[model samples]
Target chain A: MRNKEKTYNEIVQTAYVMFSEKGFDQTSLSSIASEIGISKPAIYYYFKSKDELIKYLFDKIVQEIQSLTSVELETITTTNFKQNLYQLGEAAISHQEKDVHFNHLFNQYMLLASRDTYYSERLLKIQQDFLNTFYDLLTYAVKINAIKDENILIKSQLLALVFDNITNFILTDMKLDYKKIWIEAVDSVLSGVEHHEQ
Target chain B: MRNKEKTYNEIVQTAYVMFSEKGFDQTSLSSIASEIGISKPAIYYYFKSKDELIKYLFDKIVQEIQSLTSVELETITTTNFKQNLYQLGEAAISHQEKDVHFNHLFNQYMLLASRDTYYSERLLKIQQDFLNTFYDLLTYAVKINAIKDENILIKSQLLALVFDNITNFILTDMKLDYKKIWIEAVDSVLSGVEHHEQ
Candidate 1:
């Protein structure tokens, strides 16, 4: 039983590297097993197919994002909420920016998610998690009287758009002009979230 | 010669509908030929393969966008700059939004664009065209003293971001919240373009 668990995790680790490097379509289960020195049938016993492996990877990414962002958000003080927000924004973009191959694999999954309902719901869950995270963070600021009673739900969604969409859009092209666009977007979002006196 | 051109155009039109309906992977040359009542070889004579046909359809979409937006942009007088921008934005989004199947095909092409440099350049041209159109319109307002000497380049790019990005994002799901987000984004964009006193 212990050996079985070891082999399962080993397969997951091997498949993640293979999938990120070769992309989902190009990387096969046989290739994954071959790289791990396991039989193809043995790999299938763990992941069923590449589809299941990708689904596991999606969950892993979401968990990683949640944990990583949660750690960052917890450090936000009332005195530096705005500054922290900018820092968090930079961190999020840079996190994805640093990993080119993983970005490619991640992007391909986004395209596939639209075509498959199972993936679509998984994507929706990731989006909902992000929105909820941002909402709760801002709500904390509001509760502590650090910020005004802002319409945070809308702000969160729009800010997520600014964060995720711009980050995703500028993934491939990181020219100065593109970076300017991204920074301009995040700055605009930060300012927009401020409680303006009407 | 005239008859040959007519047949070619008819094939193009038929393939567009079929490709959008069935997606590129599922839609084959034989299927297109059967739908158009032409021999498979004749279709192949015009287009080497599905790749050429897809390329042709992309060019056709670009032409349609230019003609469509040119007519809209020409009507933007100084008095109605903001409202006209709204109208133009809505027009562009609704134009693509009207055809659901085409959005799938168009989005598939976008995914492909990231993988293939040739398609990437074509997609970049579309983005540049949109930016140029917005830049020209905003520049007109600036030249005529309708607005301040705004950073038209950044404004144009950001507004184009709001226009095209939001337009593309809302293609799949036009829920009430999504519409609100789109309007929220555009409104923020318009307000952000204003010359703020330092």
Candidate 2:
């Protein structure tokens, strides 16, 4: 049983890499099985179909991101909201770097989900959860006077978009140092030009 | 000659709709031709291949956006910098709305360009022009004290990302009132948060 579970994870990881490198349409179940040194039948036994494999992988990644957000939010002890928000942004960037497949999978999944109803609901739920977590954090920060209180939904959506763009920019264009640009951008958001009055 | 130009334009427009609706991979030259009431051979006459057709459409869209930005920037008076910047954002959002296929084409083109050197260069140049245009505008706005003076590159990139996200959000999931949200967001950036004075 343990061996079967390990093989299942290994197959998913291999699929992630192949999908990132070749995109969803170009990557195939047969290619994944070949890369994993397993037979087509073995992959079928584990994932049933390519769509199923993609859906499962998408769910797993979303779950992992949610867990990370939850952990970070729960551990905040400092009253400095800028530092806290910076930490969240850094965590997101680090996670994307570690999982190179995250951005590709996200783009692919979103593109596919837009056309197909099967994936849309699942994707929407994941998106809503992400938005809600950020909204809650922003709300908390505002309550504590850590960050300015404003349109929580709009600001949350904007923040999410900023991170998404940063990730997509890095993945699509390899010329720029995305990490440096992202850090600088986040700092600008945290500290505006207005001098704080004592 | 005029008739031929009209037919060619119709073919490209039809192809854009079909490609955005069904995706580039699933769309075919024959489908576009049929949608435009033209023969496959006729489409071949205008665009040697499906790839060429796609490239032409992508370039056309990029050029249109660039021209719009140029026209808007040229009309901006230094005295009304905030209003000018807001108008620019509005123009971008309106342009994006008018070209529903822009996001679809951009996403498809990016994916294809990632694999092809020729298309990749064209795509990069178009993207760079868009970023540079906004960077210049932000720099001007800072010089006029219309907005906060900060890192032009970083601020411009963040603004670009915000606009991209707004477009994506409108295109993908949300059906909210974009005009209101966009105006408010732009205003917030222009007026900025009233910082606690030291």
Error of 1 at B59 (Å): 2.3
B130-150: candidate 2 lDDT, tens digit per residue: 778778887766665555675
Error of 1 at A17 (Å): 6.7
DockQ in order = 0.33, 0.38
Instruction: Using DockQ, give the best candidate's number.
Output: 2
Best by lDDT: 2
Name the runs in model 1 displaced over 4 angstroms: A1-46, A68-78, A137-140, A146-153, A174-183, A186-198, B1-23, B26-46, B67-75, B150-152, B172-179, B190-198
Stretches of candidate 2 exceeding 4 Å from the true structure: A1-7, A38-42, A71-74, A174-197, B1-7, B33-46, B71-74, B142-149, B176-198
The digit string of per-residue lDDT tens for model 2 on A14-35 reads 9988886678777878888888
Q: Considering summed lDDT, which 10 consecutive residues are worst modelled in model 2 chain B? A: B188-197
Clashing pairs in 1: none
Evaluate candidate 2 and give its CAPRI docking class based on DockQ.
acceptable
Candidate 2 residue B140 C-alpha distance from true site, Å: 2.5
TM-score of each: 0.76, 0.83
